[model samples]
Target: MPIDNNYTVKRIPPSDVDLYKELRLEGLKDTPEAFGASYRDESTNARSYYYTLLENHDVFGVYRNTDTLVGIAALALSPKEKLKHKGTLWGMYIKPEARGNELAKQLVLQIIKIAKETTEEILLTVVASNVSAITLYKKLGFIEYGTEPRALKIEDRYYDEVLMRLPLT
Candidate 1:
């Protein structure tokens, strides 16, 4: 089913490593390739690897009925000091059954809150085919920054990626 205001959004803790791995793998396995990594790549990472992401920075998930993880969004620091003012926003997903409820907007709202508190701006790359995601980001004040042509090669075919940014000024 779908949850409205009753559902809550909370920061993911290291204890829920398995659940995090499961949902993230599901995102990677989505038919349109929702993420930069793949299921095969995740299959190689150690269990503790995912735990590190939840533990290292503040990544959160929006859950329904206190158990159903229907949506997720993350903001993590950049690896370079010069880019410290910038953060990467990614790992956004809403279960198929959870669509049409403005959940993605709420999730991004949470992410943007954190981004404002932690970084100057957020940068994200959405697969060009993901109209819904691009539209949501734009609605949240993201502007087109650039594009990556043929960014992904999946199944012998190439796909372009659109880079978008939200300046928290």
Candidate 2:
């Protein structure tokens, strides 16, 4: 499923919400400890669950054909007042078969266009071990601001996370 250098990128629509949710849950389930919240934890809150992700967050997806969902990204505005000028990039994932293609770069590049419309900065959180994500973010103008040591834990284990930001201005 490695896509060609050329693949269609589109803004995710409401019609794609179910698939979006399914892929989101897939990412959370695959890396529960890697994310701040899990599919299990957010499954109960109606307003907070998938509404904003479906209704608010700006999304971009890469399709294999014209209608299939191979990868997706979610970039949402930061909620804090001081951070309102910033947008957060997260929920980035690609199906296992779609990993080698540049779909993620395509998604990130498109998202930067959306981020540029709002603020001077974009922020993203990545597990310290996820080098490819961090690398791509850096190439897209993000820089590592700091590290959140053991920011999340699962069982007896803890994992570090890197916080990165790109100043759009």
TM-scores vs. true structure, each candidate: 0.92, 0.86
- How many clashes in candidate 2? 1
Task: Summarize candidate 1's per-residue lDDT along 140-169 as a digit string, tens digits.
Answer: 899998899999888888889999999997
Q: Which candidate comes out best when scored by TM-score?
A: 1
Please give, for residues 12-53, the per-residue lDDT of candidate 2 as tens digits.
777777677777778788877657887777655564456566
lDDT (CA) for every model shown?
A: 0.83, 0.78
Instruction: Let me know the TM-score candidate 1 reaches against the reference structure.
Output: 0.92
Say which candidate scores most in lDDT: 1
